[model samples]
Target: MSFRNLAAAFALTCVAVPALAQTPAPATTAHSASDMGLKMADTATVKLKFVTVKPADITSSKLIGTNVYNNNKETVGEIEDLVIENGKTVTGVIVSVGGFLGLGERYVVLDPSTISVSNKDNKWAAYVDTDKDTLNKAPTFDYSKKK
Candidate 1:
């Protein structure tokens, strides 16, 4: 072949190689059953227990005992009582923050709206929306007639 033709072919091949290099490779398989076997997917099926309740629902519906914890998971308080409106609107929950063996525990009242309800797959946590000063000055409740 002529030198000019050979050189032209080489230049074309070089340009083609770079263009091909700039192209992305085809995608490979991204997921498999084993990779996500234990992960909770949006489409996964779950069986759950159900119940029905009315005004009495507020009393009959089973609720988890409130467990107040310190930053280190130390048990600081337990919900002794909750004050709810007649319509089941929880106004506030009394948290027993401190005491030695249930003796002189100081009850702290927090707004029920601060609590976050959680399930097995999810979690509920309380966010004290009130400022530190407000929470500190919240009225204490009498444990005798609490939640």
Candidate 2:
């Protein structure tokens, strides 16, 4: 009722008003199933059919040590490691090229689609369309630097 009291109350209200205004509003649904005419299922209940390869067809361990050859049937490199994307798809293969008995070896990354596999003389062989010289010229990949 007093002027001093009224002034004090007005100051307090001014400070309180901004804080209240700054408070975040409750989240609202941006989209609804009825709006799209499609019922949404829980992500946990959703089943995604991911692509898969048979274990008998090719195993990781078998591929690791497999020697890669060129069209000339000359050994170009050995598959040192496989680059997997999203922990499922095989994206690339790291081949150790231009080295003798693992000494001074340089690693080259090649896409999995670029390589082919064959069974000949009772042995499974991996082949690439590139030659040894071409693969040797590719930029080297350092496995030790991977984070």
Candidate 3:
């Protein structure tokens, strides 16, 4: 009985001693947006204004990638992107010109008012008053240098 009791005590010591001796893993920390070096903008700082869209109002989805044409119905460029200032006004429209299958493509920023868009027969088209040659020779807009 004494030997049996000693053996039981030995078993408990062998199991508990190793467990007590082992160091616990470090606590996992929950990372917030700030911790990852991202500064989140406060939505409360921006005043929200509700806007009502009319049926004639064009959506961005329909405007972007729309083929641009001249008054002669010649293809001048394609609308690539839009530049918005203060999240309110669209300042410029980015048009890709002089590209052959996107190989020699160059971007040009045009005034929003200069380009007119129309949706006739469910086909969206943008018209600019410039020719294809003029747009191809215009000053290029480099996307890599955008701040």
Candidate 4:
């Protein structure tokens, strides 16, 4: 080869060698599954239970904002929310009483047993034994305090 070509090749090899050597290697982690925020469960020891939804079952979606009626079929209050205990049991049902377009509204928590929810012709209805006047006279639920 020519002298000029030989000197150029030598200069290129010297510059490329240092650049290739400076490249970083892939990193390895020593963390386990739990350390990496993954929950590891033993299938042999864990027992999984499943729930079956029947046609007669009433879901929370049908309860919320549903109008509650008295024994006379008069609208007493509207269900605003539900209070569940221990993440499974529903202990109370919050209903809004004496409200007009959501103004001057008062909330009352009633026992789940006092309210009977039924579904007929795809329409859900909630029935209570008390009248509208009695519900308005009942104790009001305060949002600020935890009870």
Summarize candidate 4's per-residue lDDT along 44-146 as a digit string, tens digits. Answer: 4323322334454455667777889998999888887766543334567889999799888899999988988877787888999998888989999984223
How far in Å is the alpha carbon of 123 misplaced in model 4? 1.1
Question: Each model's RMSD to truth, in Å?
Answer: 27.5, 24.1, 26.1, 26.5
CA lDDT, every model vs. true structure: 0.44, 0.62, 0.65, 0.64
Candidate closer to the true structure by lDDT (higher is better), 2 or 4: 4
Cα lDDT over the full model 2: 0.62
User: In model 4, which regions exceed 4 Å deviation?
Assistant: 1-48, 144-147
lDDT of 3 by residue, 32-73 (tens): 333221123665442332233446555566766799999999
Question: What tens digits encode model 2's per-residue C-alpha lDDT throughout 1-147?
Answer: 543333333333222332333223338735332322112355443222222233235555556668899999899998777665432345678888987887888898998789897766757779998888898789988775243
Which model is ahead, 1 or 4, in terms of TM-score?
4
Enumerate clash totals for all models, in the order shown: 4, 0, 0, 0
Error of 2 at 14 (Å): 62
Ordered from best to worst TM-score, the candidate numbers read 3, 4, 2, 1
Determine which window of 10 residues in candidate 1 has minimal summed lDDT: 53-62
Model 4, C-alpha of 12: deviation from truth (Å): 74
Residue 28, candidate 1: C-alpha displacement in angstroms: 60
By TM-score, the best candidate is 3
6-105, model 1: which lDDT tens digit per residue?
A: 3333333222332323223238735333432122457745333223322222221123244654444445566555554432234566676555787766
